[model samples]
Target: MSTAQRTAPAGADRTKHRKPPARRRPHRDQRWPASVFLSPWLIGVVALTLVPMAVSLYLSFTDYDLFSAPRWVGLRNYTDMLTEDPRFWRSVGTTVLYVVVAVPLKLGLALGVAMLLRSLVRGRAFYRSAFYAPSLLGASMSIALVWRALFNDGGSVTAVLDAVGLPADGWIGDPDLAVYVVVLLTVWQFGAPMVIFLAGLQQIPSTLYEAAAIDGAGRWRQFVSITVPMLSPVVFFNLVLEIINSFQVFTPAFVISGGNGGPADSTLFYTLYLYERGFTASHMGYAAAMAWLLLLAVGALTLILFRTARSWVFYADEEGR
Candidate 1:
């Protein structure tokens, strides 16, 4: 080879065989803005949520009344709960019944209302707003008071029962029926799930129903085969939410039952009982133990729902995959 060719810089060869560019990472400086925006949320979560939870967990293992420093009691609070506390078990059973009855009733009412709302041709927005107003109002203290009044012996509900020749009695004072009043109250606030069901219903194409009709499918058959499978995801979502919320129910029960879960403790929800222990009776350590147990129960139930959702929860986009 000529001296010129041999002496040529290796730059020419290096350029031809250069590797593809490495993927770029977000620059450290560029990440600062996002971190800055997230700092408040992170601080709130740590300071308000995580710290309180940690303190409560520690307190759960101790005997801490509000007036005195906590003394370590190991799992005595828990052991007492399982073996000694009849009220705790009663609260658990009442909370379970509330969840079982209220969730299905609420979801069923919401789904039924959603289907009716979906069929409207005019004033749909007005009807939606009207129906949603109850949920928007929420299970507030005033609402609970009003609910209690309405179920009182001389209230409107009793008046109606008397008019219909039905046994006229105040449900709030009836141990056998007081819990049902609470269930009805929860079911009344079904607008949130109803809106979700409505959204899911709207997403289903009319063509599916039309095709079903062409295939000689009845309305019930069309609903069973088409609407249900498509709406299963929304149903699952609402079911999980309702179950969680039901377990934590307290305000309505407290207000309606006069803060004692009264009339034989028929409306003694778990959270209400916890509140009575913590703040009312000054059993802070026991209450904290109850709270942690509640957290575990809710988490376990949520995990079970998620694990089982694979068998039923359908996502259209994931079908081909």
Candidate 2:
């Protein structure tokens, strides 16, 4: 056979021995498992949260008294809220004051306690439980009632003040001080942030402190320079959370004020007033408008916090400072 014929036969033998290319199956859907797990939550959001928000938004633009059909009022509800409402403004002021005072005090106390707890070696769990117990019941009706009794005339707080030779009066009855009393209760529930702060503290590297110590830096200097920088993100988180929570304070004010927002409306938190307008005064439309405005205010505040956080919040994983 010729050399060309011999080469052709060799190529044919090689081709016959080679395996055919494996057939490729279509790509399997990997997102199915996640979608399956998320379907219930999505359903809940649509059925429970989103639907109610949509209804409330619609009611905000109309006069919706529960007894009668909703009447289209255009922007009257919002206009009245801004121009003609005194109680609304008072509630706004009260809520703002409560948030301003309570959030900072709460965070400060939380951080202090967290720092103390981190150094504790014995009975640490017990102390943590005791410190955190209040947050569990802080906003409950029973706690509010207990706080009211404790601050009322001849109550425990009044008696203590009297014993200390200080001015003793019913804290819940004074218009100028009733809001502060609510703020005090909020500050007392610092446990949640305390626990969060404790977690953040634990996450901090001990090597940083040791290195600073080797450089002759005092504890305070290390705390200010290393600790604060690392924990800034946690502080920012707790601050935003506490601010949002403080704005929505209602049960305590409602229970303490006997559902009337009494004592000249000093303890009239915005949510309490919204509840009063919607249920007590039968002005559902006005209440809905108030609720929407509150949502907007909180959203704005949260947005501002996020925008400002870029300048202060530090993440360990970030590069290029």
Candidate 3:
């Protein structure tokens, strides 16, 4: 064979033995299937939530009633709320009282109910549903109406008191008792926290209980030493949410008090007061200022709780931080 022919065949063999270059994978942005799936949620976030939040923030600085043009008032509204408004301070006091009293009571009842439900062997689902029904109905207009009727003078609650030979006054109308009724309403909606506690209870391992039992730990001891520590995270969660909800309470106070805050303005919650100012009294600018103040109050309280939680909350995972 000629040298040229031999060399040509060897080159062809080497070329054939070499592997082709690897094809590049598509870029992440080019993956249209995932983006198509997420498009609806993205649209909702931008259009419904983000836009409204931005608009509300902007409106909070202006004196805009529903019908009138928005006049920029700057910090005058804020100053009026803090310095010139007496009702603002009164409403703030009422809200602080409600939140401080209601949140702990609600969470305590929730934890107790959850522990009871966790221990029961039969018909657990039935009890859970029954307990949760009130929470589902909470904040409903119907429930508020029912509350008004129930606590009104000569209503069913009063009649029951009469049957038991106890004096019953206008619970919803009397200033002293009106706020208590609101607090009771908050406590009645303990079902959400109870459900969360139930989930937390189920997550605790049975071996811990068994070990406690082997050590002759009583039920109460096992609960305090084991259940509570394990459940601290859930407790913290319920506490934060309850505090936020209690501070934001409005419907019961509004409906039960006939939107006037009723009987010396005792049930004048912060939001209800803001509503009265903005919509009823036409103090839109001042009300907007109150709304921002409330937002700040809630945010500050939540931040404080989160900061304090490090001392109390126990996480099973080492990487919880």
Candidate 4:
């Protein structure tokens, strides 16, 4: 055979041994579809939330009535609020008292009812619905109106108390008692948290209870050891949520007090006070400062909850924080 022909056959064999190139898949912009789907929420957060927040923060430092141009005031609004504003401090004190009193009472009632529901064997759904009904209308203006009427002078609550020979006068009028009336209103709407606690209860392992029973532990013992540790995470979650909700309470105070936060501003919650300053009195700059302070207060409380959660909140699958 000729040398050229031999070399050609060898080269052809080498070519046959080589692998073909891999094909590349075309890149699709998956993010665009997600962005399209998320556009509505993004627009709402920016337009209704972010823009307003930025504008308010800027206005907090300036004297901006609704009609006039914003005049720079530096830290005057904040300084005045901290020192010159008595109602500001009163509102703060009232809000703190409300949050402290209402949150624990609400959570306690909710947990107690949840435990009862967990034990009940019949008509559970009906009872759950009945209990949760109040939560549905809890924050509504209609419910606030109804509650006001129920507690008003010579109203149903007052009439009942009078018939029973107890002093039920001026629930919505007494400075000492008006705030408690609103607090009771909040506590009555415990169904939402009850439902949440019920869910958390169901998630706990029944086997643990069985084991505890076998170990001679009583129902109370099991609840203290097994139930509390297991349910701590849920309790913490509900605590944080209820705290936030309690701070933002408005409609009940507004409608109950006739939009004046009245009976001598006794029902003057922080948000109600903020609204009065901003719209009613046209102290827009001062109101803006109050709003920011509220934001900070809520943020601080939430942060504290998170920080302290490590001590109590537990997770089964992971190490405690």
Candidate 5:
């Protein structure tokens, strides 16, 4: 090789072996702005939520009467609730009944209404707004007051029954019927789930139905094979939410039953019972224990649903699996 070419090649080899410059990481000072911006949320979470949660947990194991300093009593509160308290189990049973009955009925009604809305051709917006109006209004004190008036003896409902030549008892007065009134109230406020289901139903492709029709599938067959399977995820979501909400149901029963859980304490839900124990009876520790138990129950039920969902909930992306 020529000396010039050899020299150029040697210079290239030296240049190839040279290290590149190192990249500079952002300074800690640069991250300060983001940290400052997040401080409010972090402070709120710690002060408002986490602290209260920890206090509640601590109070659950102690004998607290709100007026006096808490005395640590360990499992005594839980033991009494499980063994000595008949009202505890009664409240639990009432809550279980409400959750089991109300969740399915509300979800089914919501899904049905959603499907009906999805199939509508005209005045869809008006109907959607009208149907959802009840849910917005149902939880209000005004609506609860209205519910009380409607179901009370000698009220409009009773008058209607009398006009129809049918016997009517006080729905809110009868222990047997009080829970049913709450259930009816729950069913009437099905608008939120209906709106959610309507959104989910809209996401389903109409082409699936068209293809099923092409394959000679009838309406029922298409619904069973396509609609149910496709909408199972949304149904599961709504079911879980409804289960949680139903377990926490308090307002309607509280307002309609006059906060006494009246008619033999039949309308007394778990939350209402907790409120009575904590505030009225001043059994703060026992109420806290009840609250924790309720949390555990709700958590367990949610876990069970997640476990059960594996068998039936069909993810659109799971077809390959």
Candidate 6:
């Protein structure tokens, strides 16, 4: 045999070594079960969420009063909403104001309570559960009713205000201050965010505080320099959540205002107004337009917050600021 022939595999061995092209059918077959498992969720999204949103979008451009056929009028709803509806503007303003006032108050109270709970040497569980109890009610009608009962004119809250020597002129009905009652109720339910803040605070390293103390930093300085930076990401999270919830505030306004946006429309949150337009007045198309507008506004605000977070929010795992 030639040296080359000997160095290479014999013909029979070469035939045995030659492999067939890899089969992909088994891998493709393996994906079928995952697709099958995901089908229900995909079906639900399509049937429940996407379908309703699509119908709402289409309805937003038409005049559908729940009885007559939808009359297509391109951009009329949008144009009228922007140019003609005074109530739309009022609702927009009130919702924006509520978000601005309620979100910060809720976050501040929650963070403060969280820090307090963190420092407690005992009864942490009891304090956490007690503080979080109100949030467990969520936006239930009962909670709203209770809030109205407590804060209405001559109610317990008003009585307390009077005890403090603060003048009260129709607490829940005051056009100028009706919204603030809702804001107060929101602040009272700070438990959810407080729990989240407590969890975040727990993750912070104690060594950082010890080091700051060693460097001659006082409690306030340590908190500002170390605690705030480490806890910033949690703050951003609570901020976005509270802003969205504040804009959608309705049950409290509805129950408190007797299904009318509070006296003079001061508590006409965007969602409440949308509900009235759609269901009470049967202006479903207009309501749909308003709904889309609210969605866009929230999305814009959330986007702005996310952009703003780039400068302030910190993460332990991040390699760069």
Reference-based lDDT, each prediction: 0.89, 0.88, 0.84, 0.88, 0.87, 0.86
Number of the top-ranking candidate, with lDDT as the measure: 1
Question: Which candidate number has the best TM-score?
Answer: 1
Better of 4 and 5 by lDDT: 4
Clashing residue pairs in candidate 1 (N, C-alpha, C atoms within 3 angstroms): none
The CA lDDT at 53 in model 6 is 94
How well does candidate 1 score on lDDT at residue 268?
90
Question: TM-score of each candidate?
Answer: 0.90, 0.88, 0.84, 0.89, 0.89, 0.89
lDDT of 6 by residue, 1-64 (tens): 6998865653433454553334334444657888899999999999999999999999999998
User: Could you tell me the TM-score of candidate 4?
Assistant: 0.89
**What TM-score, to 2 decimals, does candidate 6 have?**
0.89
Model 3 spans > 4 angstroms off: 1-26, 29-40, 66-68, 162-167, 319-321
Error of 4 at 24 (Å): 7.3
Worst lDDT run of 10 residues, candidate 2, spans: 19-28
lDDT score, candidate 1, position 137? 67
Tens digits of per-residue lDDT for model 5 on 1-321?
Answer: 587885554342245456232311233344688789999999999999899888888999999999999999999999999999899898998889988888889899998989999999888778888999999988888888888888889789878877888657768888877887788888999999999899989999999999999999998999899989999999999999889888988899898778888889898889999999999999899898888898898899999999999999989988998
Residue-level lDDT of model 3, residues 139-258, one tens digit each, is 898998888888889789878877888657858877888887788888999998999999999999999999999999998899899998999999998888888878888888898778
Q: For candidate 1, give the lDDT.
A: 0.89
Give a tens-digit lDDT track for model 1, residues 137-210: 65788898888999888989978978999767988888877888789889999998999999999999999999
Work out candidate 2's RMSD over C-alphas.
Answer: 10.6
